[model samples]
Target: MYVAVKGGERAIENAHAWLAEERRGDRAVPELSLAQIREQMTLAVNRVMAEGSLYDPDLAALAIKQARGDLIEAIFLIRAYRTTLPRFGATAPVDTGGMACDRRISATFKDLPGGQVLGPTFDYTHRLLDFALAAEGEPPLAPAGGDGDMAPKPHVMGFLDREGLIEDAPHDDSPPPDLTREPLELPAARALRLQALTRADEGFTLGMAYSTQRGYGRNHAFVAELRIGTVPVEVEIPELGFAVEIGEVVLTECETVNQFTGSKTEPPQFTRGYGLVFGQTERKAISMALVDRALRWEELGEDDSGAPAQDAEFVLPHGDNVQATGFLEHIKLPHYVDFQAELELVRRLRAEASAAQSDTRQEAAE
Candidate 1:
């Protein structure tokens, strides 16, 4: 005698109330402020902003706090919030060439024009947790030099381009297909794929990229250059009749040089894989580049190794953590009716088989 439960709305409300209480644990302790999270938890805020495809640090920080530090949930909140906002005119693509680079390194060349400004990075730092950071004290600050301006660095890939060694990525005026507005169709263009990658879940993209390095779809990639810096964003004003800089966003850009030995149709040339992410997310940026290269199997005249990273159909849909989490967690919801139907069918089938077996035995005895 089972009865269907009601009051789902009240249950959800009560659960949320309890959750809020738990999130703000220990009432004696001071509650964490959004500003503190934004400043101290900069990396987490950056992640939310990167995956959410929105640039507001304050909003991302608030979302992180409300999500109880669950970065995926925070990204989801930001995405949901972003959908409600009205879209104005599109901004012109920011030029990475004139970026005010804080950290820039080149793996291909020994020295470059910019002289490899390692502004702020954990690359050389020992991973040991510093106990000193736990206690607030005035730490010795590193001396800052350079006239507050880094010389405009020429792209390393540009040198290769000068020699006509790399494949040409010609500029085109054709508008890219919008993934949000249109339903996802198979065989997405490079532009659409890039859009998907920039906002794709970092963990998923990292795993896919790792799979490639492990011989799934090895591209023999070399990091041509990796840069982290701030770039100005400008939007055109039809009324004012001029473009103005709205703000600047910190970005991490990665470019990988992949060699293609030779193809039947095309001659041997260096191919490039590019990644540009909305924060100082180097790992995601690098991973994106590798995955991007692997996905270009068809266009580059290379045989598909049947790798998950190379499969656009497999990668694009699952790259979104929000959709993945929703689909994965939906199993927890009530499915009693469906399960009861299945259970009854199974029981009936088992009973019929037992009856048939009993009849067969009786007939044999007779």
Candidate 2:
């Protein structure tokens, strides 16, 4: 017997209420303030901002708290909120060259014009947990003469270009294609696809990069530069007919030097892998570069090894962990219809085989 039950409106209301309750937990526990999450759980805020493509720490912190620390869900929240935001206008690309760099390092040259600054990193820290933090003690005071805010922006590539060591990169005010709006097509331009790649799921991107390193389609690479810091964002005002500074955002940028094989027509040119994102995420930027280089094998005249990283179809399709994980988990739902069909086929095949064997024995005896 089949009976239909439907409570669409009631069900949705109940779900929302339940989600609210889960987010708040029991009233006895102190409610987590948005500022607390923004300041204290900064790494979570970084992930949410990185994946969400939003730079507001407070909003990201709120999303993290509401999502109960589920970073992806928080990202989804931020993304949803971002959609509702009215676009006042497009911003002029920040002058990375003018950026008052807080942290910058160049791997290509040991000693560059602007001396390397290792601003803040956990690289040298011991792995021991700080029990003092657990007990809640005041953190060390900031050094005197410090406003943590960085100044303008500057690109490390400026020094190289002055000497004409590398090809000059062109800048344009032309609007770039939006992947979110249009259906993705094959042979995607580097700009369009790269934007999508940056906001892609971290784990999926990591796996694709790992495959290249594991010899799937190896591209020898060296990190030429990796930088993390705040850069002022500016927008062009049509009415004002000039650009105005709006805000600053933390960003991570990576440029990888990849060994390339030149074709008969073209001379050997040093190839590049580039990644830029909104947050101090060296790992994501590094992984993004590796994957970016692998995807450029055809353009670079390198033979394709048919690796997932090299195949735009495979990488772009399966690169989103949210989509992949959802389709994967959805299989746990009721599959009895398909199972029943398979069961019938198996039984029919077995009966036919037995009859065929019986006929063969009878014929032999006769």
Candidate 3:
């Protein structure tokens, strides 16, 4: 016998109320201010912005707080909020060549024009927990400086390009297809693929990239240059007749030089995979570059290695954690009708088998 349940709406409301109280925890502890999260949990804010495809720190912080530090949930909140906002106009492609670099390094060359700078990286840090941070006193501030003599740094790729040692990625003026607006189709363009990779789930992208490194696709790559800095954003005002600087956004960019094989028509030249992401996320940017190159095998005229990272069809759809999680978690929802049908079928099969076994046994005994 099946008894139909009711009051889903009321139950959901009560559950949400309980969840809200639980998120706050004990009333004795003071509620965390939004500014505290924005400043203290800077990396978390950056991840939310990068994944959510939004750059607002304050809003990202709020989402982080509201989501109770679940980064994917926070990203979901930020993305949902972003959909409601109206777009003004498109900004001109940011000139990363002229970025005011705070952290810049090159692995291909020992020294470069602007010189390698190691700024605020944990690469050298001992993993020991500094109990000092647990108490949290005002730490001494580092000296600030202006962008004096910040001439345009020549790209590491420029050196290879000048010598004709690398494949050329020519400038294209064709407008890219908007993935957010249109339904994702098979065999996406390079621009659309890049857009997906930029905001793709970090863990999924990282694993796929790692698979390539561990001999799946096996494109031996060197980090040509990695940079984290602020770049000016410019937007064209139709009335003004020209683009003007609107603001600046902090970004991390990675360029990887992958060894390539020459065909009869083309000479063997090093190829590049590029990644540019919001905030100072180096690992995600690097992983994104590796995956980007793997997906470009067809365009680069490389043999189809059939790696998961190399397959655009596999990589793009599973890259969004929100979509993947929703589909996976939805299994827990009410499936009474479906399960009941299966139950009946299972019971019928067992009864038929038991009757057949009894008939066989009786025949054998006789």
Best by TM-score: 3
- Per residue, candidate 1 scores C-alpha lDDT tens digits across 1-366 of 123235766688899999999999999999999999998888888889999989999999999999999999999999999889888878988999888888888899878787787766788999999999879777887786732245688888998999989888735588987665575677888988988998899999999999998999977789999988888999999999988999999999999999898788767989989899987899999999999999999888888899999999999989989888889999999899999999999999999999999999999999
Candidate 1 — worst ten consecutive residues by lDDT sum?
A: 1-10
Off by over 4 Å in 2: 1-22, 25-28, 145-154, 159-174, 333-366
lDDT string for model 3 (1-366, tens) is 123235766688899999899889889989988999998888889989998999999999999999989999999999889989998889999988898888888999988999887777898899999898878787878667533225678789899999999999835689988776676677888888888988899999899989999988976789999988889999998998999998999999999999988886789999889899999889889999999889889877789977888999999989988788789989999899999999999999999999999999999999
Estimate the TM-score for candidate 3: 0.95
Candidate 3's C-alpha runs over 4 A off are: 1-6, 143-151
Local distance difference test scores for all models = 0.88, 0.76, 0.88
Worst 10 residues of 2 by lDDT: 145-154
Give candidate 1's TM-score.
Answer: 0.94
Model 1, C-alpha of 184: deviation from truth (Å): 2.5
Please provide TM-scores, in order, for all candidate models, with all chains considered together: 0.94, 0.84, 0.95
Query: Relative to the unseen true structure, what is the Cα RMSD of model 1?
Result: 2.3
Write down the lDDT that model 3 would get: 0.88
